[model samples]
Target: MGSLAFFIASLGFLLPLVSNANPLDKRAAALKPFNLRVTFKPAAYAVPSTIQHVQDAVACGASNGVTVTAKSGGHSYGSHGLGGEDGHLIIDMRNFSNVTVDQTAQTANIGPGGRLGNVATALYNQGKQAISHGTCPGVGVGGLTLHGGYGLSSRGRGLTLDNVLEATVVLANSTVVTASTTQNPDLFWALRGAGAAFGVVTNFKFKTFTAPENNIVFQYFFSPSSASQLATALTALQDFTRNSQPPELNMRLFLSSFTTFSGVYYGSRSDFDKIMNPLLSKMGIGSGTVSTNSWLNTLTSFSNGPLAQTGTYDTHETFFSKSLMPEYMSPEAITALSNYWNANARSNSRQWYLLFDCHGGNGSAITKVSADSTSYAHRNATFKMQFYDRVASGNYDPSWMPFLNGWVKSITDAMPSVNFGMYINYADTSLTKDEAHTHYWKDNYKKLVDVKMQYDPKRVFEGPQIVGS
Candidate 1:
């Protein structure tokens, strides 16, 4: 039997067959909410073990006139998985995880509850295959794909949404439907990028690729003892982004107590060296490390070393993140970032960092997909930058949040010469509805609104900064 069929067949043996009694009412006290950042207590929480369970939960919520929020990986930076308000029903999709790969077809049917780590490991075990996904392993495949997932392989392979062949979604009226290129084409287009506003996705059919034999990971740490050194490094980075970037290369810049340039080159070591040596020489970076490893190990290194989220899907950490897409990075913008970091180096009560993720290359598949093809409107962006702050749940002080927000604003305000748009995945609850619409959707906002009107006219699945909200 297929994996989904087996799961349904075994559900009777795994869970007790309950009648019309609500599962949420039976398991409410034992429920552990995913995010600690959001203080709202849900009216009830349902952990669906099967598709039927999901349908029942939706029907129950609809009957009671309570909003339903679906929690897949539970890693929403703004805690949008929790509905951003009190007294809503939350559908926890963790139990529904099951991955089945068809080697001949080079495709995998991934359950909504599957994490990137589980999916990667499964595909690797089957036939040394893999899918493009975010750095963190604990993030849900459903949520990531819904927000147009990007990662190290994105430039060459394309975003996660680009790989999706089909999706089984439970609509607002509790009707299950399959969305793909031929069936429900308009809904498929909207679901690729702005799916959260439409319905709950139960399964994703994704096109997979053969994993690369070897991968190169490199990192350069620059303390910049003097202003000249810092300027040289920053300028070299800007030049590299503008002039010499390979489609196989994915680069990221970090500005915290110091500046670090890190990236993965999905190719042989010699090829990576050929592309990176000149940039290193120009920037005067002599002490960085570059290592080559198998594809799985490379993903492991990124997760354990850079991402720092080593736990399973249930792992929860309190964090706040805001993102912006800048057309280009000017020297003045670099200076502004340095000044902000230096000014607040000691005043920060929690760990904080800035990330500059280089996006497009000359042959980037990300840019090959037209801007109007999907709701992800920032296809032409040079870099997507994020301001991140990590705080313990108990140590989270509301006063400190404003300082972090203000610092990000100051840095963004400094770059008047560039146009800025925000990433929808790194959602910011502070943005007004109009601001969110303009920044996240940009030119595609009107089309997304029309789709929302057609599919979810009543707005059953609503969260902060959601498409129709």
Candidate 2:
């Protein structure tokens, strides 16, 4: 305790330190997360504005025998950013929210705290450049790129992680190092896919690409009465995606009030029509809307409002989400999922939606990236499906976990032959560590474990489901 206090006093810069001993109000504010499903109180929360402060925070944790977790956006579904369990030291990186672009170099150096919306706006406004990323404006760049940054643009352009060129990281041993393909290559590989378990990356250097000139958004809705009807529609879409999906087109199927299919095209309207018209006809659907807009406008249309999260409360949700990256969705499994949805979707009082985002097809950039280059598994996935459910009001009930889990199980059970791996970003906290090993990273789990042994052998960056921990 004396050492911790002395260390805090010795710091030259202004650092916001919130300890568990602090009043509930202050501690609550510090520990607040984007997902309200799980709650864990950290022993200390340090908001570091500079790299020195980050290093000092890591040093303090190492000296005190306290596990350290870095929180960028605090958007982890399982609250892993808050140490997943509790009694750890949290290094919050919200102050590191700057995005700088090197126009001549054709790259962008992004802070760990930069949000998707803000990053997009800055990248485009400054350089007319962009990186493929998720649509959520509030998702932190650190978590998104570290895991898998899947979005409408990801199919055409690669994932946000794919664009990563380098990073400045604070290791668990309290040493700072630069990681990239040339320097600390092993750390760089682990950082790209399973970063949270390895170190706290203060900044990222990403190779940028020219923003598309013609950004077209399309939407198609269908009203299927029976499970078979839903199955037919999904099967048609899946068959089409497996064989003919274009790199310029990114799309998803959403099960909501209306069964809808929507996405963005990076090309002209005529080109989009030529490709989509055939799919629509095959699905036995005729009418859908297509609108072309500027890149910024298209991004804003996907967001709820402004891309940056700016408010007293950092915008949260009471929900649970699970994801699956499947090489193929068998017709039997599709029918089973449709049956489950038809039987229970409307009966439940909670707000929910199932989304199937296309990740693999004829010439997907996502699959083009070699799976062995980075620790990110499921590179050959045909589609990434996310099942999300949130409470209508108030906090989520713990008992509802099984209900959501069951929804995912229905599909996986039906397709016993397939290995539907889970996405680490949309983490399911319910799984045991052993189950997580197989579901999150299939063939790469062993390699991740070896990397963890090398960089953080003692597991300073510990969490419930963190790789190797």
Candidate 3:
């Protein structure tokens, strides 16, 4: 029998008692993801509060031969946490929020449902500890860690997945297992980069670093008269990051209201100035606003609201985003991208922006690890670029896709030397399954497929872009 037909046929046997199953009529109306572009209705919903409750939900899905997925912060750009498409059992994991620290060992046991903001606060308050994670406060630990977590601290400390030591997972068979370097080594390797495809991770143990002190936040804005000037500014920044950029210095180029460069340096003002003087001189820009602050305050400054996703996941956006992990862009590519943005952005009413996050350099911790050590394959990426566009506040227009796609093409068409890869966290729904595999996993795709076959032979943990789906 076919997969869908067999799943339906096998439901006649035993109906396990999974708690808090919303009625079919009500399930469709509730539960919205961060992105409103895709509307989904799961076949059922299970709001589990404990590990046993999670296990029972998995058991129920196994008995009924239904696919299952877990929702932590529900911040997926494609809404994949809500089964990506629909008709699968959804496990709401928001109730498992907890961040417990072991100060003696400098390790933290974080619940999968914990958001990045809350995790940051708890770690700082308890032991003045922290882990490399994203800037967005509402992003969940599960999705960020499973994919690849990049933040201002990533270049200094490494990606969040690099800090993960172990995980407690409930498998497709409803059996609990501990995955680590010493136990279930294969599962551990896969979970670091592709955790969502193998099982429902209940908890994560991460090795923490002592929070950096005296963070210096800086911002510079430029209004270039021509596209070539903008390209010159970008090229200067790229050359600065080419090699031996200090680990303590992090910078991001923003293509927004004005061509802007902003970031946090995890060091003193004198040291930050020393490191930045040459770059500032190259671009002929005066010293921008630079100030010193504590580590916790620095985190607060980067977020929109309080660093907690407690009561409800209210932050929502109707937007489309695409990412690229490319080597340094040539002057021709930057000029082409600048000209396109200058020509079209003023005529369009849609809100759009782009961010280029510095990643690879001799001093960066992200590239220090071996490429084969984990499933994440983009160790050589010089930087990751995120392109986002959205309607003001309503349902997204299908016709707007071409504008964003064209913006990306302006860069790729002008440059042929840069081998670009896409970041899975900023997933684009337009790509086919094969394209997704090639851009996201690259050489690691085959290993991820093998792990999926071993752990989830029936494709129980499924989504539209899920491995082996």
- The candidate that wins on lDDT is 2
lDDT of 1 by residue, 278-384 (tens): 98888777778888878878888777543333333346566666888776656777676666665674357577777887776455677778888778878877777
lDDT of each: 0.75, 0.84, 0.81
Task: For candidate 3, give the lDDT of residue 138.
Answer: 91
Model 3 C-alpha RMSD vs. true structure (Å) is 3.9
Q: Would you estimate the TM-scores of all the predictions?
A: 0.88, 0.95, 0.92
Where does candidate 3 stray beyond 4 Å?
1-30, 415-419
lDDT of 1: 0.75
Q: State which candidate has the highest TM-score.
A: 2
Q: Higher-TM-score candidate among 1 and 3?
A: 3
Between candidates 1 and 3, the one scoring higher on lDDT is 3
Ten contiguous residues with the weakest lDDT in model 2: 12-21
Candidate 1 at residue 181, lDDT?
Answer: 85
> Lowest summed-lDDT stretch of 10 residues in model 1?
12-21
TM-score of 3: 0.92
